[model samples]
Each structure stands twice: as C-alpha cells, then as structure tokens.
Target: MSASCPISRDSESIKKLVDNNIGGVVAKTISITPALVPRPSIAIVDRGLGRFYVLNTVKPGEIRVESTDHLNVRFIYSILNAESWSDISFEHYLEREYPIAIKYCRENNVRFFASIGYKPEELSILGPRVEKIGVDAIEFSTHYIGRDYKPIVDSAKALRESVSIPIFAKISPFTPNISELVRELEKIGVDGIVATNTIGPALSIDVETGLPILGGSYGYGWMSGPALKPLSLAIVAEIARNTKLPVIGVGGIVRGVDVIEYFMVGASAVQLCSIALIEGPGVFKRILSEVEYWLKTHGYSSILDIKGISLKYLKPEPRRTWSTPPVVDEKKCIGCGFCQQVCVYDAVKIDLIGNKRIASIDQTKCYGCGLCTTICPTRAIRFLEQDLFI
Candidate 1:
C-alpha cells in the first residue's frame, strides 16, 4: 500500500489490506503539524474507450474534443489530486496509530512501516519516536522538499543517526542524478529505496467552470496510475542496477503481469495505490491470484526465479542497422483497418479474401516505422528481425 492512498489512511483500512494478504503496509505520511488537505481533492481522469483529442489549429492553443466507437482504443488511467500528508497530527499517530498498528501487525505477522516526512529537524525528531513503536521500518518521503540532493542527504543522515531500525527513503521522480544520490544514501546507511512517489506538480482544469478543480494553492497535484508506469519502471531499473540495496517499485501497478515486470526489472517488491483506490481492497487478492496462475503456467515456481533477469540484457547504445519489415499472420488478422489507418507510409491495405477481409503489407512502401505492428488488435502484424545490431 502507498502513502496517501485511502486504504493506508487509518489502522482499520490497513487491516483490510493485511486481511487481503498484503505483505506489508506503509502508513499515510505524517508531519509534526497536521497538513491542510484541499477540498474536492481528488479527480479521476478516466478517459475511457474511443475518446481522442485534437489541437484546433484554427484557434491556436485550443484543444478540440473528439470521439469514436473503437473497442480497443482506450486511453490511459490517471488521477490528479491535491492530497497533502496525513490530516492527523504526528503526535496523534505516535500516541494512538503507531501502537495499534504495531500490535495488529505483530499479531497478524505483517510488517508495519511508518511513513514520516519534512525537514531534517522534523525527521530527526520523528525517527527515534517511530522506531520506539517497533515499526518494521521507517519510510520518509521527499514530497515537498526541493530536488537538490543536499537537503535529502542531510535529512537521510539525520534520520539515520536518530534511529537504529531499517530506513527507506521514498524518492520523487524529479530528482536528477539518481545514481549519484543513491550512492550517497547508501553511504549514509539508508537500508533501501522506494523508487518513486508520484510524478509531478501536475494540473487539471474544468473547462465548464473555467477554474481549477482542486482547492490546493495552484490546484497542482502529483500524478499517479497507469501513465506513471513507464517513468517509474525506468527509475527502478536504474536504481537496482546501481545499488545493492532492495528497490520497492511504486506507481501504476494494476495487474499481476505488472508485478512480474517489476520483478524482472529488479524490484524486490512493489506498492499499489490508484488501482486499489479505484477497485477497492479485493484487488490485492485478485492480483495475487493472477500472479500465481501466471507463474505456474510460465514454468516459474517463484518470483525470485525471474528477478533482475532484464538487467543482464541492457544495452547502452542504439541499434545501427535497418531490420526486416513486419510479417502478417493471416489467422490473427481481423482486417479492422486499424493498421491501414495508423500506417503513415501507406504500406498497409485491406483486401477481401474469400468471405473475410484481411490486411496485407506492401514491402516496397513500408519504411518499417512499426505503426501497424503495434496498432493491430489481434497482434497479426509482427517483425521477425533478430539482433538488429548484428
């Protein structure tokens, strides 16, 4: 579970996660003084199937809305929220939340991690206190802190000196020179890394009301969900490649295959937020089932069997040769014209073969831009290029 997720908001919600077989829970982030969360804080950007937008050139800088009935053309899932840290005070968590969480987790054999944040002084004060509660670990976030490494390094040092328990730094994606930062944290005795928090100081507006939806200072919030996967995955891979410490992948994990992907890329574990909020607690059980089935069918006995497998194959340079064009599999082609629609080179065409329509490619016209191969709903188009660099 992730900080700021409703499921991690309270002890009761955390129990739901544990009962659903979640390995561990990170309590919502708290600071010495309670944070002021904005009203109408969260808004879901679920632009479901067949919706697309176009830039209206006639009125420069204006966006025009468009729609279609295509079944396979759904957009990504995203959410914008002005959610701040835990509304409850740090003292309240220390006096009430931590003790209860520690007891419950001990009884259930689950690990409890307390997430705390803010300046070095605040972290120095909170660290020893949370450790006294017998938390399995302490995760401090770098949410409002600037991207500069000095402040973070200082905070990590302070927290490290304040407690003897394992400490994890929840990092923001905006931090530059991640490898260098990771090295510094490792030197300072930080035990592990949480590769991401959320991706931005992003904004969302309501065209109807001509005002921002969220009530934060600028209605800005960090982005999370399916769209955040690519960036977060890259960060996880980079961190895992550079450090010996465990990396917990966060952001945009919605399915069992996603967990497999994280493991393959070197993540020791993962955290879920948006999906849990959208689908509720049962998602944990459902995804775990999916992971089990996938592992069994794939001939893998455990997640450890595939961990860090992709790191060995990483290449630093781009391919230099032109590869073969895509090949069409007649059995898989539905002739939906999607390939033809997306092909900029006019290399694909639909032809009536027997009673069915099928897609065919003109090798002469294809520049191997690969638009059709990706757009084909049935994966009918494919490339057989083996080792382009070779």
Candidate 2:
C-alpha cells in the first residue's frame, strides 16, 4: 500500500511540470509574427459574387477560378417550334430546358437567365421551378405582336412583386413610346429590362414558287445575329441614355466585337440566340477568348473600361463622300472577267486581244455602288477615296 501511494504522487507531479512548461513556451511564442509560420497550401473555390472558400490539400496544378460576372452571358430560350406552346407539357419542357441551361452555366461559369412564355398565369407554375434551380433571373415578354402594352406591364409588375428572384420584362420595338414603358417598369421595381424583343412578322418569299417560307404569317419572330446588330445597338443605346436600371442587350451578337459594341452602348450583359443556334455552343469559348485578347490588346483590365466608350461619340455628323472608287491593279488582275459581268452599267470592259481587262468608270454612269469591288476574287481592287456626291 505504501509503494502504490508513491507512484500516484509521482504521476501528479509530472503532470504539473508538463502544464507549467507548456504555458511558459506559449507565453514566449506570443511575440512571433504570423508570417514566419508556414501555412498549408489552400485551394480557393470561387462561387462568384464575392463568395469563396478555402480547401486543404488542393490537387496539383489546379487553376483558381475567378469571378466572371462582369462578362456575364445569358441563355435565351427562343420558342422555335409552336409545339412548345401546346403539344409539349410546360412542366416537362421547363424541366428539360432548365437542366440543359444549368449544366451549360456550370460548365462555362456564366449566369443562367430565361424568358418564360408570354402567359401571366403560367408564372405560378414556372416561377417556382426556375427559382428552385437557382436561376439568377427570369424575363417575361411584355409586348405581344399586336396587343397593347398596358396588360403586359401590369402582369409583369404583379409577377415581380410575387417572385423572390429578379424579374425582367422583354419589350417589343413596336410599342409606342418604348422608353416610357421602360420607365414605368422601373417604377414598378423590376430588376431589369430587355429592349426590342423582335422586329416583326419578317417575311421571306420564294419568287419562283411564290410561297411564304414558314407558311401563313409566322407572325414576328425575334430578329437576331449579324443582321440585327445595328438595331440592337440603337435600342440599347437609347435605354442606356435614359434608364438607371440594368439593360441586357439581345439580338445580332455574332462575334466578340459585337459583344464589345453592345457594352459600349450601355448593356450590363449580352445574350445570344441565333448565333448559338447557327454556330453551336463552341462559339461561346471563341467569343470569350477573343474578347479577352482584345481587352488585353487595348490595355483594359476588364470589360467595364471599354463599356460606353462610344456614348460621347454618338452625336450625328455629316457624311463624307469618297474621293474615288477603287481601282484594280492591271498587273495583279488575272483576267477572271468577274468584275465585267458584275457591273450592271457596263462600266468594265475586257479586251480579249490584249488579254487584259480595263475598268474605266464613266462618271455619268458610275453610281459608286462598289458592286465591282465586291465581285473581285483577288485582293487586286480597293476603294480609292473619292469626293463625289451621288
């Protein structure tokens, strides 16, 4: 019994010594700078909008993902087929499209935005699904083909009030006083406005068969891609000039240059439908890369710097006349005779004996249309500056 008591007392003394030593060491280390301590490699995962996280033991050579909100891309669900209206169940269609869009956004690191079909009542069903999938925003078609905008605006306001997510209203170009409509929407506390949904029941007819392309007035579909760039620019420029709310530019964005143009006109972001449909999703990567390259070349750190650069230069100026039409180099000309055939006014003549085609512009007949320059296969012709008024 005496021997056991000694062992117990010895253990207690040892514990006291260890605690005192540890306390002394901690006190002495208090003056050590944090920078002197080696830290474990941390992986930073960015989920956008000032959100990030640190992960221990990051994989080798992992690239840190940066936020791309400044160059945000929105996916537009343009109803290409009427079956989407009735034949397909709305719930099923939404389910299919939502996953496709969400996956695309996740892979590309861009925001997902969609316009619900133009029915107000359908929002009760569609809105929940969109929000459930973590969609950043939802857009509503505010202007019907021939209907007044009052009902659309009212419905949009109601939806905006009901939904927790941001609401956008896509206004048509045909709407009278579109700027006024945008202002009214802003007053209703809408998150954003998309201007000029589609131009109108655009028509293309086969002259030989004398028939409509889509049959029986397909009613105006949205015009987009290269052809609509100028129109989109004008609409976006107007909205940018007037409104304080964010503007999402759509229509006719085919290349990175187009995207820059839209931003210059005051679009917070740009959306593309037709170009994606025409060129496929791969176009997004090309566009993004080209945009980044252009930004770097122009000494810009971000897209924000170049945005609205053209606003100051928007004032109208007198048009200048070219001094002369383009002249073809006789030595470089291969005598293809393409320019001769393209000239409508017989301004170009091919000298078969000399084996050389000479283009002599008769000032009276020459309209300066530049049709010949376009027909030249070789880069032998260029428009020389001319100061003639047609």
Candidate 3:
C-alpha cells in the first residue's frame, strides 16, 4: 500500500456504477409479494359415506333425515320355490342353499331361520349340524302334506326333545280347527307357530289343451301376493285371539304397510316369500327401509307400539248375518262366463239362450272366501258387509 486514497469513497462509486449498469443492462426485477393461492375445494363428508358416498345436501338436525334402528324381523329362506314332492331332497337343498343364506344373514346382521319339511327320520340328519349354527330357530314345516295336526305336534315335541334351540311349527291355513292345532302346539311346549303356508296343492288347467301346467289334473296354483292379505289377516287375528304363543304370519306381504297390517292383526313378526321371489333378496332391505320410514313418520319409537293396535277397534259381527256373498252388477256384466268357470261352489249358472251368466248366492255353501272376485274378468262382483253398511 503506497498511499490510502479514499478507497471507501471509490468503492461506493464502483458499487453505484455497478448498480446503474445492472439497472440499464436489464429490466429491474419487480419485488414479488407472495400471492394468496385459491383455497382447495372443500369436501364435506357424511358418516354414511364410508360404504357409498352420501352427499351432505341434507341439513343437520332435520327431522326428515333422522336415522332409524332396524326392525327385528327374521328372514327365513325356503329352498324350493313351490311345493314339489318329486325326487327333491330337503337335505340336499339345505346343504347347498343354507350356507349362502347364512353368509348373507351374517354380513347383514339379519337373523336366518332354516325350515325342514321332511319326516322325522329325514330331518334327523340335519339336526346335529343345524344345532351348531346358532340360528334363531329351526322351524318344522307342518303343512307339507295337509292340515292333520297330530303329526306336526309329534314332530314339534321330538325336535324340542332333541335340540336345545327353539322349535317352531309352520301350519296350513286350510286346517278345519287352527285354534285346536295352536292349542295343542302350545300344550306341547312349542316355542312359536308360523301360521299359514302357501294355500293348495292348487292346480291350474289350460282349458284349450285340458292339461296342467306342471303336468297334473289341476294346472292352477295357489294365489299369492296382495290377493292373500285379507285371508292371512283373518287367520292371524283368529289365532291371536285364541293362542298365547307367538304367531309368525306369512302370506301376501309385499310392503311395509303389509307388515304393519299383519302386526296389527297380532303377529309377532311377518314372513315374506312371493315378494322376495318376485323382487329378490334385496327386497328385505327395501321393506325394512320403508318400514322404518313409516314408523318415524307416524311418530312411533318401536314396532311394538303399533302391534295389535287395529284389534282394539275391531268389532266382531255375526258371520252369517253380517257377511254377504258376491253380487254381480248386471249392467257391468259382459256375459264372458268367467265368473261361472271360477266359482268353486258352482253357484253361478249361465243361460245360453239369454247369453247371460246369473250368480245365485248359496248362503250355506258360500264361506265368503271371495275367490270369485279375483277371477271376474269384468269388475261386476262386490261383497256387501252388513255391519259396515249399518
């Protein structure tokens, strides 16, 4: 260092020159304040979205969107679609079908009850195995052959003696004295009674071919669905009036309304078959959903609250005096002779010359079953209830 000559000032001048040169050589970079990025899409999720996405369109604290506890209805899966007494083995069908139904019930938390219809010796094979599944109950199909109550009572007794699980007897509606059968079943310590199997070894005939659909004299089959509700209700009400054992009603149940109807008639629970066959296994979920919706809408907390509620208003009127047979409106009649062909009582006769079918109501023979109303092509027949009219 020869001399110290204001190097600090010179250094400041150099820095200024460098800054000016940089500014002139290139455009000055703008100071970049961090920009606020648009907020990411907020996804509002619901608890029910775990299985399927349930949108939160429904408001919280909304009474219409309230959750309901499921009803305690036992689902019994029958192996056969219709009654077939051919080479069909109930055990074989049970072995193949029961596992599928059991898996479904387990996954859904639904109770499954297996029904065995064979003789005591035949059902004995399944006894040990079924006892291990811890099913709700093992029901013995008592209506396999007919309305004879002796065999059913004996079977129930045998089953109860053999297994620790509860035994239920499924009986037919065609029994002359259903109350007697129920009383006998209760006396023998039966756990429950499933009232009414599908009506008939019913046959249907194709008049043109004069042959049965399933290869028999009578080709017609038992009517199910909405048509059998009234009959089921009557039987359930009758049994409820007489017996103390829990009655499980089965017939023509399609919807939650039908279930409620059966409950009102004093059924502890109701079973569905035709609806399940027509719709599928998923029909059970739909029925439960609708039932829960109905219960909540009606301000009912539990299904027990509505059971037998209709019976209180039910007044018994004299059968002969209050019930009347089908009356055909001649004005609406088309002379198709469908009514004459359908009458089981043979009460309708057609005048070939007049081209008119006349219905004579035989009070002694007409049990007011209303089979005629179903087959009438023209909506001419109407049942007049004397009590309701009064």
RMSD of each: 7.5, 23.3, 29.5
TM-score of each: 0.89, 0.58, 0.57
| Candidate models: Cα lDDT each | 0.82, 0.54, 0.54
Better by TM-score, candidate 2 or 1: 1
Worst 10 residues of 2 by lDDT: 23-32
Residue-by-residue lDDT tens digits, candidate 3, 1-390: 000001101223213222221110000100112112222201111123211111121332332211222333323211112222223243443455345545544455445455554455544555555666545567666435554667777777667777777777776667668788788888878888776665655544345887554433233344445556687788888888878788888777777777888888888977665564445445666777667777887789988888888776667763355445677767555555666777777777655436554555566666566777766544567776553345
TM-score-superior candidate, 1 or 3: 1
lDDT of 1 by residue, 1-390 (tens): 444466788888887888888888999888888888989888777665673322122232333433344445646588777877888888888888778877888888888999888789999999998898788899987655565778778889999999999999888877878999999999999999997888778888888997887788888877889888888898999999999999999888888888898889899988888888888888989889888877877889998999999887667875545635788998766667888888888889999999989999898888877778877765679987563335
Local lDDT at 318 for model 3: 38
lDDT of 1: 0.82
Better of 2 and 3 by lDDT: 3
**TM-score-based ranking:** 1, 2, 3
Per-residue error (Å), model 1, residue 102:
2.7
Candidate 2 off by > 4 Å: 1-87, 94-108, 143-148, 216-222, 316-390
Q: For model 1, where is the 10-residue window of minimal lDDT?
A: 53-62
